[model samples]
Target: MDAATSGTEDKTPHRFHRSLSGLGVIILTLSVLSPGVSIFVSGASILQQAGTGSVIAFLIGAVVCYCQTALIAELGAAYPTAGYDYAAIGHAMGDWAGATTYIATLINMPVFLNLSAIGIAIYLAPFGIPLSATMITFITIATVTALAMLNIRANEMLTGIFMLIEFAALLLVAAIGVWHAQPDAAVCVLNPVHLDNGVWIAASIGIIGIAVNNSSWALAGASQALMFSEDMKRPETIGRIILIAFLLTVFFEIAPVFGTIVGAHDLKAVLANDAPFETFLGQYLPAFLLKLVSLSIAIAIFNACLAGFVGLGRTVFSMGRTELFTAPINHALTRLTRRTDAPWVALLLLGTSTALATYIPLTAKLLLLSGSTTILTIFYVLGVYIGRRSGRTGARYRTPLFPLIPLLGVGIVIGEAVVLWLDAETGRKSLFICAGAYLLAFCYYRFVLMRRPGGWKMRGPDDIDALVARDVVDA
Candidate 1:
């Protein structure tokens, strides 16, 4: 009859251990992002599109994301549940939005993990390594799956270790690049690639859409830390973890990028180079160390994929517990075990999907489309006004600039989604997939949930917190 231990007819919810610290939350959230790895992957477009304006694009992305995180902080402090954005939005809009958000997550999270893992092949190719992208993808997905199924604390430790390796590598690169700055490099860093010839093509400016897309992806995972709020030791600091992570993510992702180009006094070389860190290390450091740095790139992504696994497991479990999904799948997802009290079934579901995805001939464009579906979920911010108006007040931390933050966040996200839709590289078709997911969820909610009594209004943050408290007592 232990409600926290199983999926069977348990009136009480499964609970997360409060043994996690704020630092653990930050480490896990930042690992999910993998800034060092992400900047390299995302920076490829910046070199192609905005070039020197890459700095500006990254900063703009950060500011827009900051607004979104502000709203999340307020909601997270009030609710402090693993559901995070799912809960925040659900409370404001009702079952329809909740179900749609959940569906978007189930699609986007694993797709992101799978694509990022397979991307290891890009670095592997530069070394003349023999492994195909498919093989690398399979190996990485398998390894991370096994690792993700471990105890949450152990996973955190593993992520912490990998995160440190990447961050240290980034700092080393930044310091050395800054030290070896090429003449006029400082001035050029502030200019766009189009202006490199001291001339500008007004038409080329259109690609700011592409630059904006690259920068925004780096600062995502806004709701990830709060997804672990249930397991965190100090719930009060959950709100702060995101803001702290944002600052560091920018420093690591943006600074090193500009440093590498400026240090060499060669924008074209840096832009054309696929393996900037490896190239830099080879010239300034040892060859073996270059190989090690390449290995670290793979490891950083693998670690990040594992973080996605853990977050996906928690999210599915939370949705299932609240009966937001079908009973059978929810039954499977909520089957928690004392082994680590982890949601093994949900983790397995994600692992299997990611492993399967690794084999398919998925392009970066396709993956971007799949991942952008989650951008649809960020619209949940619109619910902030709805929640506040309905007396869901007294959050532990209210977002500064209140309505402006939430309103601007919703607007920026919508604009980005529009840009992505218009993107010749990946936008128009991805819009179909994103739209389809939303359509499916809305249909399901209308059919299955609407007729149910008291299903119209979803639980707000306080309501979710109360359930967790009760589950603790029941356990």
Candidate 2:
């Protein structure tokens, strides 16, 4: 028996139904990206910082993400599993590094889910709904968690419907901006400027760089394709799915952002508003349409939360499949809803954790942690480089330019990390906190896991042939 499969006869090795087509995975991954939320939040930040220069900023962000994607795509195709970064990094780097990544994810994902859930309240407020942010958050969490508990294909269908609504909202935003183009808007894309106080001034390179960093968050999540690899019919196509998702995400997100920047009749006022995207829409859209857009935004946030819950459960499910935890705990986590194969136990744990996270008072701290979590991509890219150096390149979809692309990705991520650390109030502390979590993870692995009976063992996804053979025997 393979080491990866040993001691699992009692546990019964489980496999995903693998019924999802490539398009199904793409839709689910895109839901995870939540283009609408990305634009409304991260895109708005870029516009505020770089103004017309946001065009350049997002373009730069796209380049950075493209490099990162090459690394993600290659590794994802190689180790197609629900474990995602943990599996890829562990196989490429080492168990210690993979543990660190998993720990970071453990810290970051709940905070993000909390944030996404609460945002639904803000979008719904325009509809004259009277609900506290906390109340809305709990409700959103419950709703999304319930939806996430459904079978994978059912969730995909629901998210697909919600995705269409969000896309319409994004398309409407783009139309409003492009249809009402401001004079010199084209020039602003080339020679960008921001509103500084009452005067318009050239956007400094540093400011544009900040915008790029913010924009990267908006264009992020395409690598979420990693989460559904085990569910796909053709895992080999995962790389193409990731790249396609990134391109579409860039187009969907950037069009609305650039359009809003160019179409604004009053750039100064739009930028000044706390809810800039809302303010922008209010200027051009009738009250009814604005309300509809607001409703769509609310749906978008809910869709994102649902998709996040689905992925988070799988992450936990993957973690449970490893020898990192005690047998009882692992057995509990790997429990499935026999009928649908949903990770019910993992989903329940995620829901409970997310609910508790929503109650965390230090929202600013959570936000800071969320911002700095982008550092995980650096570890991911390094894994690709390490794998290549060791000639462990069994992946069918190799990233072009070999070491150059992965190296450039590392450079960009490190630069982002340095920038985060340099910010005294928030970023610095966030990185310190992240470093502490990693240290704890390393200690656990080095001192604890290494001393275990069988030591740390890595498991890849079950082979397709083996799965088929097993099914035949059972029948």
- In terms of TM-score, which candidate is strongest? 2
Could you tell me which 10 consecutive residues in candidate 2 have the lowest summed lDDT? 1-10
Give Cα distance to truth, residue 347, candidate 2, Å: 0.6
Q: Distance (Å) between predicted and true CA of 389, model 2?
A: 2.8
At residue 208, give the lDDT of candidate 2: 88
Q: What is the lDDT of residue 251 in candidate 2?
A: 92
Residue 337 C-alpha lDDT in model 2 = 73
lDDT of the structure predicted as candidate 2: 0.79
For the record, the alpha-carbon RMSD of candidate 1 to the native fold, in angstroms, is 4.1
Each model's lDDT comes to 0.69, 0.79
Stretches > 4 Å off in candidate 1: 1-9, 124-131, 194-204, 280-283, 360-378, 452-464, 467-475
Query: For candidate 1, what is the total of clashing residue pairs?
Result: 1
Pairs that clash in candidate 2: none
What's the TM for model 1?
A: 0.88
Taking the tens digit of each residue's C-alpha lDDT, what string does model 2 give over 189-276? Answer: 8998888886889999889887887787678888888888788889878888999999999999888988888888988898877778
